[model samples]
Target: MNLNKYPVTELSGNGKLVYGCDYNPEQWSREVWQEDVQLMKQAGVNLVAINIFGWAELESSPGNYSFERLDEILDLLHEHGIGVNLGTGTSSTPAWLTTLHPEILPQSADGVRAWPGGRQAWCSSSPVYREHALRLVEQVSRRYGAHPAVRLWHVSNELGCHNALCYCDVSASAFRGWLRNRYETLDALNAAWGTTFWSQRYSGWDQVLPPRTTISAYNPTQVLDFHRFSSDELLGYYSAEAEILRQHSTVPVTTNFMITAHIRTQDYWSWAPHMDVIANDHYLDHRLEAPTIELAFAADATRGLAQGSPWLLMEHSTSAVNWQPRNIAKAPGEMIRNSLAHLARGADGLCFFQWRASVQGSEKFHSAMLPHAGTDSRVWKEVVELGGILERLTEVGGSTVTAEAALVFSWEAWWAYDRESHPSSDIAYLDQVHAAYKALWEAGITVDIVAPGADLSAYKLAVVPGLYLVRDSDAAALADYVAGGGHALVTFFSGIVDENEKVRTGGYPGAYRELLGIRTEEFLPLAPGDTPPLDNGTAASLWSEALRLEGAEAMVSFTGGHLAGTAAVTRNRHGAGTAWYLGTALEPAALRETLTQAAAGAGITVASTPEGLETVVRSNGDRSYVFLINHSHEEHKHAIQGQELVVGEEVADVVVVPAGAVRVVRTSTPAHPTNGLPTGSKDVESD
Candidate 1:
């Protein structure tokens, strides 16, 4: 995708920051709809997403439809000058359809069909489900294809959210078909899956299944392939709907992506090309010890999924969410800080899950633009205030955030790394990535989460954390990137397996061994509570590799344990660039200090930031917009000089960023200049 052509300003026709929420007028009466829009306008909502869950209301029966309610809603929104992100209402199959064809319902891994009391009950691979879904999409697109108020076409609400993987017979048949196309022969499939291990070799394509519940653990390779198949199945459904929507409408089409790195079911790097606008639905993960750090990581990952083009914050919370074991409300100004955090990364649109709180649904407790307390609530006041803030910071739209460092995030690697029977089950792929990303985020350095195959030429440094499954092409690309003077940090457990989950021959980290200039004798995985001593009073846990340097210099080594005196970390000078290999997961403090030194070695500048303050700069050529966010309770003062765009104040030398507050400054300094870097380069550059 040519990112330059699809900048945020051009994607949003009016160049205004889109501020709105998922507006479900079907939940209310026509009399209440008027009041909803009046309140929406009062909150400065210019865009309203509608028809998300109206499939039952849209089609009461097969081949029978009703557009009366939808027509009234659209007319009201148009009259009020609010644009519409029209949804196809295909997320949930109607009760009538499911009642008639129960076969459309997705079957669980244990072979029980799902009941239809909730949404997304249909099987993605079922032809019957796709037939009806495409039909509904066509009808809705034809009805509002050229409507003046319709600005964007939302294909489906959170595709593959509930039924990402279905183990029904229909899905099994589809999985076999997908495998046939991929391997082309049963013999190749057996070879790739290493079926010879347990005398379990497939002779015919029909013998293949969807990795159902097994006696022992399912074959890791089979499970991995099934995961790929399931993801592609959902992507196929989305493409089918998008194709039909495109035939009837010329407006941009998108589907909200649940882009949390921990959710490894969907490969958004593959899905990004299909979307006209990359829209993500992010919820703060309260389960994490540091939810704010995870939020920033998700935002950066979402922006990178757009390939640095402008994307949308399609759904977030104004306050507490109904889900999660312990539903916690946002503290004062936390919501504003969260929204600004995404905006600082690269979101052009700020939207939420709902406009009004549901009065009688499972999500009744879910916060919205207008809470259950009505317009007099504190949540409502914050929503209105945020809307005003977005209006004033409209110029931040269409800007791009440049990063001197890039982190390679691979979904394929995540699947393989997180599989059972690993060296250590505690080594999570995203947790390691988040640890590295959080270190950089705290240093006030912007980092782009790019794919393995993405162009790395613009980045001075790249970090790959626990890339267990390394494709030959991807490895070659990274090798060339480092050879061209791009600095990289390759972590433990990387380069161990191939795309087929087969261990590479010769040595560990097979493809990168030469470029990284290190040979691993064996993996010394630590137990759950074990911590091995390392240099500089830092410890290593979870994973450790016994490394032997070939042409690399040991940067850090083990001081205790069986692998004492072995290299824990090494740096290799390869061609014009440098490659740093971390053989073990270091302690947090050590990891931070090591990364700081590595980044400086790569000529990447890290801002001197306070402990809880985050600084991000989004640039458009020569002009830069700096976002200073204080995430701590203590106040922070940064020496900054620019025009404060949020409150329209002129900032001289020092600016005080209050606790839980954000300040956006427009300055004339260029964030990053080419400086002899090749144009349209795909890999990293060196000094």
Candidate 2:
């Protein structure tokens, strides 16, 4: 299927997976390059990304280019039979460029310039910055375009990692021009942004600025639009370089996206199509209660961005990352489990942050493939072992992940819902979304995290949690989807506003009131730590709504608190399907059981799984790869009859997975008549 979509097979693997990390030879001397290549060959590394932050090294002064060291490094890697994922080395502005044009540097929302000590210092919308960066990109592309070692071209290290939004005068001028293109007249602009609230109506285009430090909270719509403008500005800068790269090179080009718990700058749904192949950089956040769950969510979201096609895991850590407040070292076998977990979700290429550990830099203490402890350490052993495992499982490459459900996720809603005023400050945008995902995850169900406006027809069940904003057309499309035989489970604090952050105005949860067949007058938010019991023998917390049923029937009612005896959860029978509504946050087990029960007519089965085992399947029409990641200490056995690719054994009826290790089985794919996706019961794993 992807052959028609993508003509290149190097990134997706012909017979071997891409196994390596960001190899920054510029950080080390020429004496270490040979040793690094030897170690890479021993570890089964085939691809290494180089020159990611080599802006200063490649071009020391303005318009002066030097590439003797890069030429030598590329030639050496080619001699060692390793392919290169080349970078344009334009992620950070060079020191001379910054000194020449200090105005090209980015500024914070409160008007403090981000200086040259860090990377991504240039303003995204600066024409001066773009002219210089594009010139460098053109030079790099022309020089290495036909080089034998080049496989893929990396546009930038991470496009919007630090500076997505800038508040400088140049950026302000760009923002006004962008608004002019969006709204032809000032009257339309004022109406859309609701600038009439604080005498902020713009009589002239230059009067409108970014939602910077204001007296109080600025207009919510203006803030929302500024976020939209900033995301577009970043995308435009990327497109400029991509156009230049395409002119000289035919390699598939992409930039690593930060799809972790934090770093929510660019709305990736809008930027997904512009990329040749979707690649992500994910690091585990140590602060969350369930960090592994967040990791899985991030991986699944990346797969969704690729539209179920196999994607690349660009950057992860070998052990502890240096950036976290308390950098916890991964356990003895934990690294392999994490890497395989991403592969199970649909990552074709597995790479880490760096090939070798740095001795002097900001990330000097960060872990790497070759750590400070050298090759005799546990981290290095696991790295080699994982590389071998990846080599053995090349059959899993280019396989699409199977999904039967959709979890609605929106960055626009994440921007608008987290604004100053809400019914409760305790309720966050991702709290309920993650809770819903965790419920499905514990039940061993797979879901595609889609946008608010994505098509729900391909899925049987759709889950929407805290989708606070919805345009009328998208809302109507969702209602039509449910009416035409799609099951939906929507939650509270959803459909409260339009695109302009304006209230939908009829009732609370304004957009979906009629579709849900429920009428809610107001919100009944409890204080922190108040877990109220429900009539169905479960408790809820954080938020509740006082509702009256129009056509829906109450499934669960509140037993206590001010909104006593009101409906806490409801089920409405629409035209051909059902709609489930939740008004309060339920416990994980309670939510799982509810979702499992609500999935009756949704064409997918929700089955129970083992306590600490995770299962995922990827298929390429002829064969299927089942990845069993055991996170617990005990070995687990599964009734699978296939060749265990990891251990290189043909098992009859059972496959044994060791503690904290991963096993992938290559088996015959199940036959499906309509969509060819795996669907049935627990044994087939559509569960």
Candidate 3:
């Protein structure tokens, strides 16, 4: 297996580390740059992300360009021995371009045009926008083509803010072209969109307009279509800019993907194939304990794009983020613990959001290594300590890890449920997904959060919770996996819709009804304590489907309600294995029980019983690293048989660690020292 599939950088043979943080020298003078490099060396920081917001500095006018400032920054970094990921500086449109072509600005869903001020505001479908953006990329690549400090290329800033689809004429034309390319005939388009309703039939491709009031009223289908269009449109921007970089430079190219933030838009799976390396930012204000699962899932998602290659943990906060409702500092060692946790999950490198904290502007308050108070702060000290430990270790980067199970995350499913104007507005898609992840995590399963098309043949079990939108390809893949003797678990609202957010025509659970052995006749949406009038008091919610069994048997049913007698759970034999389908939203406890039962059917076993003590095993060939983290607030007892934790050599029945603590153990046969070197420490160089 390729160690690159595991997330780590090769600084030297048998000695490596994931690259370091994003360093911005634009805010400081040349004098400060020298000191910053000195501090970075002390911190063992080897990589720096630069030129992220330097578009204005790079190009003052449409044709005129300036590289003196960037040249100095790049040259100085190389001189000081720092590796840099050169940014194309196209994330935020330059003031001059936005001024000349106001149409370049993004238009919101309600058709409100966004004014310049924030990043990711460019109209993706605009030809003028693409031309200037690509030009800037070409100039940047050509000027820094062979720079020693430039190791990788970051195409643009976060793709989150672009909002993809615009109501502008340009976007409308692009959408029409996209639709035509997707479906050559008008009949195919009408059938795909179910335009038979509301007399929305099209005579020709020209009739297709921007998905807004101009073409259609507040139609959910249009809203969802616009989202898909916009995401693809922005992907075009990334692809265009990346193509220029790839042509000019040999360095791997990537953009910081904010997956969790854009749950409603920016489809990473569709754009993943284009990125040479996957990098993403992970920041969560609430549910701090469970956020690591999200990070692991994001890495898994990016790995899906990279064909199972490990992803870079690009922009996690060292402490608290200013964006959260409450900017709470990562308690004590939680920051470092979380950083290592990313590696445990399959992150190749570790980097924070900002290097030096800002004193002014929007991100001034965002957490960083050197806060506004300079190097005397706790954050800097924490970074230095972590850096010291990294300098001493060699096995952290490019090391292999392995997992036997995977979680199937579908953005198409997420979008389907998110866009639905459900009877109860509280039918949360994220909550359910998270809840399932929490259960699997608590069960001590080494889970790789992946998209639908990911290979499940190697995995003993694939869990699909709330898979509302089941693309035909995905359904076939899952069906084949189960038929091949692999176990599959699917929940309510799943297999009901296609990729375009259109409901499947034949019965409930749509395409996979046969595999699942159940067919839904009607949906029963219940309130928060009112569950189908069943005295069983089983917690169920917003939407419940009354299913009819075909070749399967029911596991549970509503004690009362119009559809009380319908099968709530069914199991069907498909191929050499089985498919379990849930017909309603089961309460967390019940879901956990069901998961335990299903996992048992698939031959999965938990390592420990404590909550928040998560473990992920990643292997490369003959070696494996087991990451055991206790993320709870209290100390816990934990033990696993036949594996030795390399952090502190001790074989025992139980181990104790403080809250929010983490440890990495080496568990290879003929156990070698965790560090490759017998004498000296690892040499960390800034890239």
Candidate 4:
């Protein structure tokens, strides 16, 4: 099966990096709209996403719609040579709809109905809400479907961003209906949810409800199923609107996905297939110790969700976002670097939250292309500069980031891995996945974040981190991948539970024990702040497991703790390849060393990267573009030679990448030297 098939090249007419922001003409007057379009043209903006939250403006009352203002704005933008990514205006319903159908409002787990103060307050499973939302979408699509300015159909702003999970009665009924479709009978449902425990078995579907607020903890399986149902419910809503849009529009349809590993609301892996063009709204978690790395991780995951195809960066901050506590503004030139970073990954289009800063409302303080400081500000200058840079790099569109290394990331595993009764409460699924990804990223190796069922034939190494929930088919796929000469690194806590969150019988790491050639007898979860020594002089913390090797050779053993002398890491030769199992979490340095050693065994070359520098290569079969981003405070010299695409200058010998700046080099020759290192590179990887 060819998994990497879909590719969405251009939503706009031109094959250039789309440069625009969310244009909310309703928020401004007619005169300001003209000025906004003039300024947009000055900045070389080509596409603007409009009508994201215009439901209240479009529909003032039930069955009463108005489009006079919107029509004028669209015509003005079209006259200015700007394309429109038209939003369906269903992200938030009007107040009148909620007033008439109070049940459309979502309720909390404690049964308190959400008020109409914020957006996305409508229950996704409410048939009333769906009907009204679809009605609005149908009206909007028919109005602007074939308009000259319409380039893409943005279904809703960010589906399920605020209300991914709802415990209202409407949602409960929908959950019961979804469960019936999945299990068919009450007995099967009971078995899947393990309802026999605590005498919670249901006699009929009506007896089951969403895992609501109870005196005690709810059933884990029940909560897990609800999570699935809630994601699907939102997906169904999106699909309904998209279907209506397709009935009237011929443009590509999409909804901006909040594709963050931290947000466990909707599984984007399932949602990607429904989108005509994959679009993502990413915001950096400024709280992380390494925020840039997290941004890169999110970008890679977004590209992977698009099946390595070009995607749209639908929304990002121009400077400080109002939502964060501190709301730190971007440093000088940081905006361009950040935008280029996303472009380096796979984003063909670049857009911000809004074209102009809001004068009022919840996001008033949020930065935009035109901030409150006006066009004379540094933000405006940078936005214009980025537009010029994007115009010169039009060839970057439709390019892809290829990788020989793959990391298996599953939302199902993430949902089940972080249960309350886990061996270690501190074992965060995304943290572990990011740890492995960061190690590889810092090594200057590009990694693809793939699903469990993705074809592994193209990758040289596959890394599975903390895969707690393993389906039978996924396990078999991994085993087959390794048996067919693919290297795999399976970490601790993997293959322990099946799809139903049930512990696999017989042994720890159950389904993989035979293929991994190791049997984990017990889990040795360490105390907080405790770091035990490993045989390699590295420390292990968070978790450790007692493993007895069947055919695997012990690579690292515990030097202390209760499981002393046990294999903390092992390697087994299966068929024509090898599978390494780490029974414990190692320190970052130790993990890097282990990964480097395994990668070397597979003959995969690791690029020697400098500190605070990220290197990514995008290829289009004929040309390769090397993007080197210096995320440090000091200037760094790189021995990369090529035509710098951003500046249109030929760099033959060494290039000085200023601190917090980006350099894009277009070259026909390979970026790395024959020895897997750039010319005159200082850093070297030693085994």
Q: Report the Cα lDDT for residue 134, model 4.
A: 89
- Encode model 1's per-residue lDDT on 556-587: one tens digit a residue: 88898788999999999999999999888887
lDDT of 2: 0.84
Encode model 3's per-residue lDDT on 38-83: one tens digit a residue. Answer: 8877777878889998888888887799889889888877777778
Candidate 2 Cα misplacement greater than 4 A, ranges: 1-4, 7-9, 12-14, 671-687
Error of 3 at 215 (Å): 11
Overall lDDT per candidate, in order of appearance? 0.84, 0.84, 0.71, 0.84
TM-score of each: 0.96, 0.96, 0.91, 0.96
Decide which is better by TM-score, 2 or 3.
2
Residues 316-370 of candidate 2 have per-residue lDDT tens digits of 9988998888999999988888999999898888899889999998999999999
- Model 3, which residues run further than 4 Å from truth? 1-8, 11-15, 214-221, 287-290, 421-424, 532-538, 561-565, 640-655, 670-687
